[model samples]
Target: MQLTVFFDPKFLAIMSNRLQNKKSHKILFLDNTLDVGGQEKLLYDFLSRIDRGRFDAVICCLKRGGYLKDAFKKLGFGFYEELLSHKYDALAYRKVSRILAKEKVDLIHSFIHPNTVFFSHMAMLTRSVKAWVLAIHASGSPAGGRLIGRFQKLFLSRVSRYVALADAHKRYLVDVEGLPEKKIDVINNGVDVDKFHPGPSDPDFKKGLGISEGEQVVTTVASLNRRKRIDLLLQSASIVLEKRRHVRFLIVGGGPERNRLEHLTRYFGIEKNVTFTGIRDDTPAILRASDLFVLASMRGTETFPLVLLEAMASGLPVVSTDVGSVRELVVDGESAIVVPPENAEALAQAIEILLTNEEKARVFGMKGREVAVERFTLDQMSIRMERLYEHVLSRSRRAD
Candidate 1:
């Protein structure tokens, strides 16, 4: 009899050295802009909770840094705005190369496809960057209607690793985007449980939003984009209002689709029953004030929405269309009600079920809160990201 164990010496050496080394690596996160959206906010929340002692983070926006730049700076992280006059700007490329050389960035992590392409070009200009990671926050590629969308397949080679928000999202990357399965890491998006928890709804907050007493509130927090299907929600609201007039639908967040969605709301003749709150900083408060949360998004537009986690964390029963990786977060019937996407009748029926049955909705909310706290918390996500950084840096070192 013989017992033999085979292990790569390089892996053992890397593991042994990682235990003794605590050197911090500087990471440059590149994005098209720091707009007030879920992806931007996710990056902010992760950065705020990331292990400051283990890693350093810098944000470089190819265009403007948008509103979140100042918020990022308040966290003591470096932020830069490198404007690109066009898609292919030689001067901007040179400027970004200087930034890479001066900052001595150890790794480059980019969000969206355009920024990934920008990172690929900069990698060729500077030898200081050792590794780069691409995070596909959305479900499909060629998002945001950019010219670079046509050429992303040619530029993905420079990415050291790819991050998918959920298992289904990972499959899409591997099957549709042709990314290698081994190189893709599934890191589920997490929410701050402490910040968004079950709490008493403020009367003034409800009153300010025109929510009357004894009225059941059904809220949906999503960017008012066409893919979000705000129109579908409004159409569903019309049906729900026909039955439950006491139910008020609160449409939170804003985007380019506001005007068109508002027109659709008017078209559905549910303007009085629905209130578009636009983009607000007080999402936690809004979620707390709601009796039920609804998300009516079309397929391929969402990839594990952060708003769903916020709703669950706030202890609100969710009635969402089955899209993206939503099923990964909530059980179809236990934690929340899942319905078919793009179906107003089914969406309306799901909302009515939760709204009409008070006890069921309460139980659903409790279970959802449990799920959010136990599985998806800021601490859990931050620790996983820290380990990922270590793994990428170690591999980059071994390759050298």
Candidate 2:
């Protein structure tokens, strides 16, 4: 009798030696943009930390490029922006296929949904392109939006590998879409622990934001989207201010919901207490300035929020609703506080508890920082990803 086991301390290293002995495999990382979103940030961190000697990597953006392209250029990584218009853009598809073949890209790793279809075809279309891996960032549940949405749901079955950011997302693909469970893998998005670690509260940072001395600042850094529930935070601000007037609500990040949510703040008459700072790049500094962090997202699909780790790293206790992987990341009254979704009153109360109790909040923040440093660091995530890539490649090699 025999048992199968897995251990590969030298997989990447062996691959690197193979590359030196022969030809190296190239990677084409396809995404919608190089923006400051979760998936984009994950890519950026990977672009920095992955074992560069093991494989050659180039980041290719589908449409409008963002700040990250410039960052990549500065780091001397290949950056290309080609607007695909839509997934089926024939001209864009041809261009991508040509690049993959001409560049000798071994695999195409897609970060968005449309790219899955585009690249999967490019693999067949190019005739020699090998592997295609798709990372499902959203919940991936079937929504009855339009004809296009229906087609997207239908297309999910044909992707090479369906990678979920959380177990919930994997379950959605398997249970909701009937995708094979064996084809799905859970890879939680990781954070840059060094840059986002628990820094000392910057007094100057608070002063720059016009926050007076000793006045606590509670903040939420997320897109001003309906899913993120920025309006709920505004309402919670109204409730929190009525009780604790010394605190300020700093709303970071921007989106289509900005003007409407700002109006909602005015409607609630808490505009004085709420500050809408648009899509801030200085998020780590802002988190350092904050006393507590709140993620009031109404969406159950948010598997792992990078902001929660950022908050923890900045030494700020978190007050987020019990949704998605929030339960996985935070412990009630221990590492962080969790409330029910859409309950602004409860949300505000949780924020108030963290605010009113300074010592407990600091302890929670410290514990959260510990968890982040130990478990969720960028290095750990990069190594995990390197292994995943190797696993997919090894399977592909075996199949061939």
Candidate 3:
């Protein structure tokens, strides 16, 4: 068991140990929680698919372990749930130190903010580890656009290496966070295309939601939050109804903003056309049942959303704001329409184009699916990460 501090790329040390070259190294990943966000999905998917023969993995989540944690365990992976007492728990430090010693962790991967600081602090003091790797989720930065930027930048600089979600993230690491280019890797968030691809709606989706056969349904599956801009969704849906009557909206997630968003729908007089299904596990089927998929988010927070890839894999053309790395995946006309965030008129018009032209929509959906299958597959992400782990472990041994 080797416990270490923040990662060092150029590390080469003299040591006294009989280290084998091919033994599977153990890794510990500390994620803030197991919520159903795109970043959480990326972390969980990596935990599930990484090569077990080359690496032994254990995940210790701070709190709120979702169904995916159990799903990981079902696949024979080890997990430690709800170890943190609270968001700023002092006891968490001691508890994590014990787990590190007991598990004999070789490397620590920190996902989200503060966890990097906490883990790096522990590892530096303990002097028993090899490296600390930080996974930078886009939302962890200052999409809110104010004092949060200062905090985000401070937190980013404390890590060993930054694993970015997209190329935009890597750029921010270099320009904003001042991290070296070699210290950042832009590993785009990937989905399990086989699982997220088009599926027959559970035979009950329409029945449960009272969606009739001839209704034009559009679904957006994201946390009900300010960044998601559910109000913009409702505003656009109102515009969509002017061109085509009887268009229905299906919102398939819940959060703090659900009540406000619901009120906004009524305020816009399109309450009758919208249905808030709350948080749901049947995302692929819900997306499959939709005539179109939309994601209306501001730029900084929504870099490479997993739902966009899922929508593409489900053969649905997307209409999203040109935010973050969205332009990297969604071509203006080829894959999906890219609109400016908060522009109700543009959003509505883009969605209407896809809805009105079935032939073009089908072509875009097919092209998006091809991109998802070829570039954003879970297997490809796992393979890249497996090689990363092998490299990390090999370097760790050489440093000894």
Candidate 4:
């Protein structure tokens, strides 16, 4: 009788290791939180579309939970939570070190403030991770003023690589933080062009919001915060209504400034012309239903506003304040009208220029759409990230 022999368990383990060595690189993303902000959304978009055949993705947060936690879970990623209790908690260092060792993570990419400092330090101390990439999405001055800026500058040199969301932000790091310009990589924020393409306004959405068919819709999708300067949007809306009574203003977000903004709407006596659709999930649809998109931010908090790209993808012309990297995104008289920040009269005039000139508005919208599809698609961003990962991994292997 012939006896068949199965492979030994030790042999099988060795074979498995060999196969895994030929497999995709494992990447871990560490963020301060999973909240529904620009940075969090960008992380989601990048992770969701990254080529799984080339990179295995995992996510962890310094804080335990956030609004986007469920959304991230739904994307079928491995997730860890709450590595720290307080800012200086030593237990976090141990936890991070243990996680890196256990997962056999090849690379770690961290975003935003303290998370960047913490993860970069851990990667250096443990030497467990092969490469560390830090992503900074906003200008440091408005992120938390000069104090937080100092901390970032001090810790940034410890990481293996750096990413900035805009050229303006890259300049900020070099000019204000004293970092070498060559070390930073500028990756502009991108959107899903296929999902946010130009479409007919949803008739049901318009009706539900009490917007009539013939009225011009001017909309802004931003958190109603003082820095956002939404009050200026309302003041401008009032000015637009006096000249064009057929126009309607749609404000699409919720924040602490909601009550004050509502009061301003009443104070201007144009309550019927404005409707605040608080915290909508259907932002793409809202953009389709609008004639113009406006953002009157009063601070340097925005590096590259993702909403501007979304508005362009939806075929809506933009009118925004000259803040952060907005001018880099929008040409002065082509894709958008850029006005000085905090000037209600200038903001109103810009809005009226687009409101009255349909041909100019159409041309601007079309050009914006073209620019977004060419430079800011999700696929383009993912491809750039893949290149970055490969480059860093190649360098690490050479060093070893």
Candidate 5:
């Protein structure tokens, strides 16, 4: 018997080259707008902290200018804007396809609706891109009503991977959209703990908001939309004030519903107690000045709210509605006080409980901070995403 050992020379050479020259993977991110929202903020955070040696990032938005445009440019990443005037623009789609091919993007990660639908199809059209990842940040039907919702379900099947902001979102994708459960992955939004840690309250911030020295400030940072239920929050503020008149409410965000919400404050006769600080840039400072955080969102609108994490990281106890995986984010009695949505009385009661017990509130804040640092940090999220990219790339290569 003759012992023969044979190895393919081409295979050996390819392996040697791969080890010697590790090529950095190029990733492209697509979004409808770079507005100052949770999804956009998370994208900025991921790109800013992602490992530069292993991956390069590029961003393209459907709408041209947004608050985060300058921030992305400061990160030394290329940014492109392809404005889509209509719902279905064939020219815009072609332009995006060309961009993906020209950039040699290995992976295309798209967030939210039309971006997810558009880029996934574009990846198929380009043929050069290895994978397309779709991320769903909100847990509800697609925007633009039912027809667009149907289109989303139809297009979502074409993407190579799906990421949900929370498990509740994953279930929605499966049950409502008929997506396979195995195709979806749940990755909660994370915050930069170091940037949002507990610290001395900013006196200037409080002064600007007209918060008195003895008044306890309750702050909420969210877009002022009907879905956010700012009306209910106003009612809750009125309820809280009836018992404790020294508390103040700070509503920080700008949207079409601002006028209505402001009117509701007047209607409830809590105008003196409620301050509408429309769209401030210094969120961490505002959160630090706050003694408590509340989010009274409507049911089924939220997935995993980033503001809650920011508040937790800021060492403030939260009182949020039990909507879309919020219970998963906060332990009812331990980290936050979870209450039912659309119930102003319940919301006010939860706020009063925290306000009455200073020691218990302090303990909850400390525990929340610990949870945020351990479970939801920028570094941890980046590492998980890096691994996910590598896994997708490996699978694509094997298929090739």
Candidate 6:
């Protein structure tokens, strides 16, 4: 993450008391939580590679900071947790504003829904911050319903700029949510290719997961949530197993929908062929030990999933529901077999097609790895993001 914190010279001159005479402009990265999720991991990766000479970076979790707290701490970035206790926490907002003022933060880059809403309101309340950027990682309502969605949009209308992970999502924000089209930047998700690449399948790892030798592995790494549609994947897995018995399905990650998904696997009478690994830190290793990757997310939910980038980086042929910016990520027939969401037959057919044809699957995997390297590397994403931050900062200067 290149901090590239820019502020208006006039504001700096007028607010001399609050503004500091420092070489590096401070930035505050806000999020709802520090849970082991894609957003948090993305932030971690950005911070790990941040250009410290250009700007100072800090993170504040509005709610709870779970799992990744120590990881962030080890990276030497300042981390704050439990800044907001409830929805209507006026004092907490004031505290956050004070922190912004004291830090002399030049920018506030917030992620996802509730945190974006909170920071949007905070941007209105504080003068210390120059730019407010909110990245929309998913589509649909803002979680509570039309009422909350309206409130969120109303608050975010005043933000400095918006980061949409895909052009499809950028259109949705302008068309459905009535946000300014020019304010949205479509920056695709990226992965660390060095960490995830073509490698030999680990026989020991497969055996530990109850996968027998010579059994092909089809894996999906996602939170076991309804929007992720892990149940639909299980249904397709059942169909695939009826014809292809020498295959193992690994449903990675844990969420509220775990028990129901497990029950569904049993209901399909394919319990022996499926394994739920809950959550694991060794995702790169797991990806290397798999034959294929699949994502059955529901329509209008996911947007430029980082897991897909990871899978592509790992040189695995993909089978994904045509949702969000999947088309932008992988060529339909070259790198992956795109299928409609909630269609088990299509998913099963695509899975079977890839598994049956080793040469085709290998070619797809090779193409996916090529795309990952050529288009979606961490350095490429960071450079683009740095430029956006600079643009937003420069625009803020002109506006002031």
Clashing pairs in 3: 2-128, 2-129, 3-128, 3-129, 4-129
Q: Across residues 31-136, which tens digit of lDDT does each residue of candidate 1 receive?
A: 8888888899999999986765567788888888887878888988778885688776646766677777788789888875564476655684356688878888
87-153 in candidate 4: lDDT tens per residue?
Answer: 7675677777777878888998887576557666768666788888877776755455642455555
Candidate 6 colliding pairs? none
What TM-score, computed on C-alpha atoms, does each candidate reach? Answer: 0.90, 0.89, 0.88, 0.91, 0.91, 0.90
lDDT (tens digit, per residue) of candidate 6 on 301-349? 6778899999999999999999878999999999999999889999999
For the record, the alpha-carbon RMSD of candidate 6 to the native fold, in angstroms, is 6.5
The lDDT of model 6 is 0.84
Q: Write down the lDDT that model 4 would get.
A: 0.83
What are the lDDT scores of the predictions, listed in order? Answer: 0.83, 0.76, 0.76, 0.83, 0.83, 0.84
Tens-digit lDDT string for candidate 2 (1-400): 8999875644566566776785555778877777778878778778776665576787777776786678777756567786587656747776676677677787778855555465555564445556777776765322322212555555454456767766776776677656689988877677787788667766777777767776789899887778898888888888888878788889888889999998998898877778888877788888888889999887553768888988887777999988767776776778998988889999988888988989999999999988888777788778877777787777778878
Better of 5 and 6 by lDDT: 6
Candidate 5 per-residue C-alpha lDDT over 1-400 given as tens digits, one digit per residue, 9 for 90 to 100 = 9999997664455466568897778898887778878888888888877876678888888777488889888988778885576766746776677777788889988875765476567676567588878777766632412223665665665577888777777777787656788878777789999889899986776888999988998999999888889899999999999999999999999899998888888898999999999988789999999999999998767888999999999999999998878987788899899998889999999999999999988999999999999888888888878888898889889988
TM-score of model number 1: 0.90
lDDT at residue 102 of model 5 (Cα atoms): 81
Query: Lowest summed lDDT over 10 consecutive residues: which window, candidate 5?
Result: 140-149
Output the lDDT of residue 269, model 1.
Answer: 82
Model 1, runs deviating above 4 Å: 1-22, 141-150
